[model samples]
Target: MTVTDTEVSGRRYTVHNPATGAEIGTVPDCGPDDARAAVDAAAAALPGWAGRTAYERSAVLHRAHGLMLERAGDLARLMTIEQGKPLRAARNEVGYAADFLSWYAEEAKRVYGTLIPSPRSDQRLLALRQPVGVVAAITPWNYPISMITRKVAPAVAAGCTIVLKPAEQTPLCAIEVFRILHDAGLPAGVATLLTTSDPAPVGDVLLDDHRVRKLTFTGSTEIGRALAARAAATMKRVSLELGGHAPFVVFDDADPKHAAKGAALVKFLNAGQACICPNRIYVQRGILEPFLETLVARVAGMRVGDGLADGVAVGPLIDEAALAKMERQVADARAKGAEVLLGGARATGDDLAAGHFFQPTVLTGITRDMDIYHEETFGPIAPVIPFDTEAEVVELANDTRYGLASYVYTRDLDRAVRVAEQLQFGIVGVNDINPTAAAAPFGGVKDSGLGREGGPAGIEEYLDTKLVGISVAR
Candidate 1:
């Protein structure tokens, strides 16, 4: 067994690429003890790492950002092989992840505290932000590199040492991140990567430990709820980026071709594994036919094959479970009388037969009673529904329990502002499919998860506030 193969209790889990079903590598099956050890290491490094001036920490992060850019190609290749996203998309993700590290590096020096005026003459009151100590950061497999960096960058920027628990399927990418930071002169134990197939032991140990002060997780809403409940006992500060049932609303004034193409691009990104991808679309009845035609044309143009292939656009789902789930949702929608406008089943080409490939599908005539209407179809399936009025569409959009992200396309300025304000989603895209950046806040409200990430709000999640007062009266 190689170093990558961490044998814990004589069990090793092998990771394979869903795009081609090829064995990528194996990692250590870490247990509770290993998890605890990672926390201890972080704790041991906390004081030294946190004691440094913000400038010093910023320097290290900047160096890491530089390293990330320099090695982006290798990193992107590794990510594509492990996560099964197209090579172009993987490259973009690597660059985006580097942006987070670079942005937070500068933001670290700007974690400003405020001073307050006291009612009395001789009293002075001030507020200061302090590091939250060791952090337990858990990231999911989809967009593995970006998710880990998004959490890790801010935590480190806030002067908090962290132990990253990356999803089992994408441990190598996480390990590569650590390697880059280590090369950038980040002290050992300041950042640790713990790879494990069984997360229960690690989660239990982290939640039980007082040394771990903050927990940030990116995953499904069900798991997010369980983690939040478990951490409630310890009262650890938590940030959860959970599930999203996003909606893309296109008005009659909008260009049907542009809107349709944008929808297809966003929906098919990462094979629609993104939490914020447009889950449901509400187009004005007048433009529905044109939108559907353009959307089908775009969907039909997408190439589903190995991620490494030059012209391939759509890659495989992460695993058999995801493939089965996509199948069920399609079948459920069909049973409820939804029309399959285009490809509705798995791709049958010889090139994609061994992989977990699903064809990009378009559906119409869907009703609220259908599973595709409410359930998160985290696959390459577009369910388009028609709406008559703005009020009716807004009502339909806000009906879901999730409020992560939403999109709107229209020429009316008043309507755009009105609808965007009325929507309950955390992030809104106006004539845009992508709403994410390092300088902007990312996260959602309601069941989509609590708190925020990115922008100034992100670093705040890793910090605690303290108020101090001084009075001198003789």
Candidate 2:
């Protein structure tokens, strides 16, 4: 939609449409000066924002949520055109994003502190959670709206100001979200967005700015590492939601059809670009063949086209680089003797071939040594491996450096609970494929990330604990 951010006055960067490789918008490639300005604005606004009562902040966010609901369709369409997710999935993301605003709005007023009695009868101690000052939220492009909402909701709820830098590819959604919140009575300078293509510069600016007391990021592990290192220098509070190679395990007691459906749903959602999407599948030998057959049939049935197209199950990858990466992974797996059970070819059609379209692919016979099995395949590709024993499968699933999310399907509740405990991921799903919810804590362990994103735990990321003591005299 040609969203240019000349309004902010900075370096220019183009946003391209993944489905067509066309420039949909141009935003300011904000530099250090712009970042400094944003930080100054946030700092200027913090005093008043922090002085407002929790109910006041909650009221503003609630109004923002109402605005989001009214414009949900428009935001979803923008996400589809800019982010290359199916229309239905884009709509779902908008709804999910709105839910974060609503959930955190109520959570804002519920920030609870506790009192502890001292051994001495005259002394009492109070523990309180306070806002962590200015927050620098760097979000990814996959779920632009939700990622921003996830970070901003908590920060705002905690009475903290924020300077957000959204991914260059999908900054429009976040910009629009900020605008909506601003319109919903968010005080000027309480929140600001800085768009920049160079992440290094942004990270440096955010790290160097003393006004920025915290940094929250969602992206690649390498970038997360760099940001963490930089933030550590400043001793800024950091919350990272990094890379993942989640395992989707199907036990012998699983329903083949159900497992196949779950695999298809999770693998193709957001073109499998989500950090927590199930990329690696470990199926028990008993139902391996039937599960593979069902998965192949379902993948073959998916309609690959533009995200804006009605009923399109699969959309283009974010860009040519992502498409090339997926192709290389598929080729490497095939070269190492992995069987192509379903679709494996790059898409070719009148308009589809010109874009970043790729068919939903399934690979079997993948071993532990292959890159596709161990690495994160952030595309619409699923690789299935057969395991003989529960212990062996659990070990294999935990072998990767990432421990973001894991899935298991079993009718036996005891076995499901045992396997769930054995898995080292932050979020585990037994029968349901959808593990992410507004009410549940979502994050990762190890290299996947540090800190949580959802539920009550999410609010803690934006808060700082302080203890106060009072003595009573007789």
Candidate 3:
């Protein structure tokens, strides 16, 4: 796993195993030269890659999907080692990532364009969707495999070449994915991968490169805003899936046990580092107490240990900064009088102290003013707030600047649909906690991000429209 680059700087850094906090491998510290080379590689491959028949592109992606499946276990283990997610969760993420590639493979041939009717009988108007050209894809550390797949699959499906800069902390997973694609017969320059410790410099290089026609990113809102502003200089097409403070609303009509389980599933996934993870839980006043109790019991039963361990339910946070941020958020919430229902203390055992570990926390009596209630606490922390009426709760849920994803738990089908329709989010799950799917469109309505990342809408993000009108002699 030692990656060497003679062209770039001779500096090398080690990638750590989060579970053991041990050095697993070393990667080159890529610089602007590497970034420019990646962009140049993508630019060189664009014409041929884009000119390939849709069927050829689909076949290549199918090969990549097969390779991903063949290496699923290895890739999952790498994800666990670097990202600190439970092995099972990492495996599931790899599977989900493969699904995106397979889905977009089929979608490649289905990028259909419509024909508009013309007033003149002899005139025919045809509109076609074409590739936007070379794409610069920047992925986040959380859900590393799937996030890369979400951006790369669609861009490739739309017949665009890509220069991908994966987060340094979780670069191995993307590297493995790129290796799989390379083994599956992708041209060298069609999909180039680069790893860098410095994101700002690498991002600037990508943004300033005129050959880069589109920029697709998944990260913080601050970074996304800066990238958007820079990309605007060239008027490059941009697709961003940014930060979120998603609310999980449990209505009084919902089954307490079911809602608790669902909430725990969403809140604890990836140590609650996912952008769409439920940061706030708004339970109806009637079922608030029972819901909190059940949720606490569920969280208490979870086993926290190394991700490589078979029965571990939760693992360490990605890094020290993330752990510190979560701790500050918890302290702020407690100072504001929010009740710590169950596990609010960080683990301090000799084995756990070295790595970034936080107890899955549940907070009650949270008001609108509390930082935990309104802000995105990107950790295994859930603040349970009570709401009296549906109108009040929905308003509170939509109050945040982020409109990425939301959850509603209720047996009342009518109420579920009603609440879902009113919630100003891009994706809503009624009973299920998982809102992401290969078949559905996924994106945010507001600051969470612009443009969609799944289904037909995702493909459209990498494509441009062209209209051709022909006049025939009558």
Q: Write the per-residue lDDT of candidate 1 for residues 164-283, one digit (tens) a residue.
A: 889988988988988888899888788888888888887898888988888899999999999999888888999999999999999999999999999999999999999989999899
Ten residues in a row with the worst lDDT in model 2? 1-10
Q: Candidate 2: global Cα-lDDT?
A: 0.87
Give lDDT: candidate 1, residue 412: 92
- lDDT of each residue in 1-474, candidate 2, tens digit only: 111233344468889888988889877777777777788889988999999999999999899999999999999999999998998998899888988888889889889999987898988899998999999989999999999999899899989999888988898887889888877899888888887788677668889987799999999998899889888888999999999999999999989889989988998888888887888898999998899888888888899999998779999898889989888998889999998887777888997976898889999889877889878999999998889999999998999899898999999999999999999999898888788877678899999899998889999999998999989896
Residue-level lDDT of model 3, residues 1-474, one tens digit each, is: 112234366666778876668898887777788888888778888999999999999998999999999999999988998989999999999999999899999999998888999999999999999999999999999889999888888888889999888999988888888888788788868888888787778788999999999999999888899899999999999989998989899989989888999999889998888898998898988988788888999999888878988888989988888888888888888898888887787766877877889899888878777878767888899888888998998999999999999999998988988999999999898898887787689889788999998888889999999999999899
lDDT of prediction 3: 0.87
C-alpha lDDT of residue 126 in model 1: 92
- Cα lDDT of candidate 1 equals 0.90
What TM-score would each prediction reach against the true structure?
0.97, 0.97, 0.97
Candidate lDDT (C-alpha), each: 0.90, 0.87, 0.87
- CA shift of 379, model 1, Å: 0.5
- TM-score, candidate 3, is 0.97
The number of clashing residue pairs in each candidate reads 1, 1, 0
